[model samples]
Target chain A: MSVVSAEALRERPVEAVPEDAHDDGLAPRAKFLPSLGAVYRAQLSRARVARIPLLFVATFQSIGIMILMRGVVDQGGREAQAVVAGSAVLVVAFVALNLLAQYFGQLRAAGGLDHYATLPVPPASVVLGAAGAYASFTVPGTVVTAVVGCAMFDLPLTHLWVLAAVIPLAGAALSGLGAALGLLAPRPELATLLGQLGMSAALLLGVLPADRMPEFVQYARDLLPSTYGVEAFARTFGDHPDWATVLLDLGVCAGVGVASLAVATWAYRRAAVR
Target chain B: MCAVRGLSKTYPAARGRRGAPGTPAVRATDDVRLDIRRGEIFGLLGPNGAGKSTLVRQLTGLMRPDSGSVEILGHDIVRYPERAARILAYLGQESTALDELTVSLAAETTGRLRGLSLKDARAERDDVLEELGLTALAARPLKKLSGGQRRLACFAAALVGRRPLLVLDEPTTGMDPVARRAVWAAVDRRRAERGATVLLVTHNVIEAETVLDRVAVLDQGRVIACDSPAGLKERVAGEVRVELVWREKAPMELSEVARLRERAVESGRRWSLRLAPDEARSAVAAVTGGPAFDFLDDFTLATPSLEDVYLALGGSRSGVKGLVKA
Candidate 1:
C-alpha cells in the first residue's frame, strides 16, 4: 500500500532474472494479421465512446434527406430508386469518408504517425486496420438507411441482401480515401475540409440520377468512388436485377479501395520518416 | 546493447536562393559515438536546444541520421528501423496517442502490440499497475488523470512488454517526489534484475546525479563530456560554492563586498560565489567571521555537485541554486 522508495529497492538483494525478460532473445516480430486484429480491436474500443452517438446522427441525416426528397418524386420511378440508393450509401460516406478523414487528420497533425511507427506493427496493418474499423461503423447505419429507403421508394426488399457485398466494398473504398486525405494533408483543418468536400461530392454525384446529368457531370460522377456503390445498390431495385452490371460496378469499387489503401499506407510511411 | 558510430545529423537550413549561399544549417548532432552496455543506467543531459531530443530521435530510429550507423544487438537499426520496436521500449516526452484509451487498456494494448500473449499482457498490465501504484486509477481515462498520473500510465505502458533497452525522455517530468522515486525504483530494479540498459534523457540533473551510473553532456550538438557523475564532478571537486544573503542593501564600498560583487552572481540581497576550495575557505571565513558579518543575513559553504559540472561544461544556462535565496 505504501510507495516504495528507490533506496528500498536498492537495499534488497538482486533477484533472479525472469524468463520472459525483455532482452531474452529479442521479442519476435508480431505477425501482420494478428497485430492488425489488435489494432482493429483497439480502434474499436477507442471509438466506441464517441462514435456511437455520431453514428445515430449519420443515420438520421440520411433518413432525413430521404424524407425531404420524397416530396418531389410522386411516382416510384428510376429517380426514386436513385434517390433511395444514393441516400443509403450516403450514410457509408458520412462515417467512413468524413469522420475517418477527421480522425486520421487529427492523428497525423498531432504526431500520431510517429506513435504507431515506433511500434513493430506494419504500416499496412495500421492503414488497413483503421480503415476497416471506420468502415465497420458504417454497417448498421448503411443497413438501416437502405431498408428505410427501399420501403419508401416502393422497391423490392428481396435484393437488399446485396448490401452484404455493397457495404464492405464501398466502405473500403471511402475509408481508404478518408485515411489518405487526412494523412496527406499538412494540417488537421485541411484534412477535415477535404473530408467534408468528399462527402459533399458523394451526396451530389451519388444521390442524383446519372442519366439526367450533363455529359461532363456524368464523367465527374464516374470518378467519384461512392457513385459506383450507389449505382450497384440502385440496380438491385429493378424488376430483374442485372448481376453483371452490379458486379462490374463492385469490381471498380474494390479496385479503387485497393489503390486508395495502398496510397494511405505510402502516406503513412512518408509521414513517419520525418 | 546499443552502439552508435560516427553519428552525425544536421538539419538543413530552411531558406536560400538557388545560387546564393543558404542560411547556416543547424547541426543537431555532430560526430557522436557511444556504446551503452547492458544493465547500466546512462543519462543524457543538456540545456534546452542542446540537441538532446535530436539525438534521442535518431537513436530510437524514428529519424535517420545524415551519416553514421546505429546498431542494436547486431541489427543495423538505421537500415531496419522496423526492428527498433522490438529492441527498445520508448516513453516519449509528450505522448497523446493513447489519451482516448483508459489506463488499463493503454497498458494492455501496448503489451499486445509488443507481442505479449493476451493472458500475459493482462498479467503484466496488472503487475505494472500495482508496481506503479496506478491500480486505483487503472480504470480512469488518461486525459482525465492529472499530468503526473497520465505520465505514470504511459510509463506503465512502456514497461508492459519489455524490450532490451528503455529510451525514456523525461519520464518523471510532472511526477511528485514520491512518484519520481517510484519511477527510478522501477527502472533501477529492472536494470539490476534483468540487465536492461536505460538511455535516460532529462534536465533533472539532481536526480540524474543520483540514479545515473554514467552520463553524457552535450553542448551545441557536441559531446563535451561523458563520464560517471562522480567522475564528471571530479573536474570541479577542488572548488567550493559560497552563498551569502545580506540583510540589506549591498555595502559596495566595503572591500569584501566589492570583491564578492566582482565574480559572484547577485539576486536581490543574496550573492553566490564559486571558487577554489582554499579561496572559498578564506573568503567564507573573512566575510562571515569578520566585520562583514554585521551585514550578513545568512551564509553557507558547500562542495561542488553534478550541476556545477554541467554549468562548468559551457552549457547554455546559469547554475540553479538549491535554496530560494531566502
Candidate 2:
C-alpha cells in the first residue's frame, strides 16, 4: 500500500461539489449586519430567562444608592446632580460590563468559541451581537433609575432624552471592556471576579461626587469610561446644558467603545484558534 | 473535495511558574498528507494522543498549521481561513455551549448563520428535525436531554443548510444504537442525494468499519495506514484472535495454554492470543474439553477487525512510519 497523492487520487471519476470552484456557492457568505442581527436575536432569547431577574436587581440597586446618597448631599445642588447621573450610568455598567463578562468568560472556558468559529458568520458579528443583547437589557433599568432619581432630587425632566445617547455609548464601552476581560482570563471564575471588581469601580467612582474626592481618585475617575457618561448626564441636569461638552463626552465614550471592541475582537480571534 | 498536504503544527513551550524554565513543546501534527475524494465517507482513526483531532481542526482551518496547505472545493483555505466555514459544516465533539438553546432553535439559528433566508432556514430546520426523529424533542433545551439526544441535536444543527463537506468529529459518540443508525442514515442520504463529502474523526472502529469508505490510522501525529476497512484488515490476514477467560482457578499445565500464553496479551483474567485459524480451533477445543472446562469461563475465536489493524500498525506506540495506502 502507498500514500495517495493528489493527482493519483483524482484518477477516479468522482465529482464532489459542482458549484463555482472559486466561490462559496453552497451558501453565500453571510453578510455582517444580517448575521449580526441573527446572533443578537439568538443571544437575546437565550439570555432573557437568566438576565431578567438580574436586571431588576441592577435597577433596584441603583435606585437604592440614590436614596442613600440623598442623605449626604443637598437637594437641587451640584452634588445631587452627580449622584443622579452616576446612578443611571451605573445601570449600564452593571448589565453591560458585569454580566457580559461572565457570559463570554463561561463561553470561552467551556469551548463555546468553537461553535461560533464554525459558523459562516463574521467574528465581529458574534462579539457585537452579544454586546448588543446584553446592553439592551440595560435600557429599561437605566431609564427607570434616571426617572426615579430626577423625581427624588427635584431635578428637571426636560433633558431626560439625553439618556438615548448615554445608555448606548456607555454600554458599548463597558460591554467591550467586559468582553475583553472574559476572553482574556484563563478561567471563568477569574473573569467573574474581574467583572464584579469593574462594577464596584463604577459604583465607587462614577456614583461619588468628584469635588470631595482626593485629587488622585478624581484622576482615576476620568479613566473609567462610564464616568464620562456620568459627566455627560450630570451636565445635562444644569439650567442650560452645554451641548458641546455633552457631545465631547459622548465622543470620548464612542471612541473608547470602538477601541475596546477592537481589542475584544482580537481576543476572540486569538482564543478561537486554540 | 478536501486536500491536505504536508501539514505540521508544533506548540510552543509553556513558561515555568517561576519564569526560570519551561515545559517542552509538543509537536501535535507532523508532515501529514491526505486526499479525500468527492462523495466519500472518510474516517480518521487512532489511539488517544495520535493527533486525529488536531488534523481535523487544521483541515477545517480552525487551527493554522505551521506549514503546508489545505484546499476545500478548490479554494486555498490556508490563505483565506474563513472560507472553511463556507465549504464545510464542522461538528466537533464539544457541543456544551449549545446546551442553553432548545433543539429547534439550535438548528434554525445555525441555518440562519449559514446565510439561509429566514423562511428557508425554518423550513430546512423543520425538515432536518423531522428526519432525525427529533420533532418531539425540538422544544426541549439540550441540557435537559440525554447525552445521546444532545449529540443527535448537534447533528441536526450541523445538517441544516447543508455544505459540500461535513467534518464531524465523534458524531455518534454517546448515542444509543437507534440514534446512531438515524445519524448514519441521514449522512448516507445526504451523500447519495446532494453528493456531500464527509470527513469523520472517531475512536469507534466498529462504526468506522461499518460505514466509512476509507480510513487513515494515525500514530504520534503521522498517518501509518490509509485504506479501506477490508484492505487494512489484510495487514493481519490469516490470523485469528482467541480470547479466553478463566474462572476462579487457572488451567494447570495445559499444552495449548502454555504455547498460546507465550505470545498472548493479558489483562486481568482474560488473555488474547494471535493464532492461525487451525490453532484457534485447537485452543478452543482444549479449553472446553475434559476437566479444563472447570477452569474456563468462556472463550471466543474471531476474525481480524479494523482494531487489529490499528494495533498491528502500532497506533499506540511513540512513533510509527510508512504509509500503508490503498
Candidate 1 lDDT, tens digit per residue, B91-173?
88766678878899889888887877889889999999998899999888888888898999999999988776899988987
lDDT tens per residue, model 1, A203-224: 9898877777899999999899
User: What is candidate 2's CAPRI-style docking category based on DockQ?
Assistant: acceptable
DockQ of candidate 1 relative to the true structure: 0.41
Q: Which candidate ranks first by TM-score, i.e. highest?
A: 2
Query: Model 2: clashing residue pairs?
Result: none
Best by lDDT: 2
Question: Tens digits of per-residue lDDT for model 2 on B1-326?
Answer: 77889999998898888767777888888999999998899999876678988999888778999998998878888797787888889898888667778899889888888888889889999999998899999999888899999999999999987788899998987888889888888887677656888999987777888899999988778988999999999979989888888886466586756776786767678887778889888878877876677888888889988767776776663221122211
Lowest summed lDDT over 10 consecutive residues: which window, candidate 2 chain B? B317-326
Using Cα atoms, each model's DockQ against the true complex is: 0.41, 0.36
Output the chain A TM-score of model 2.
0.91
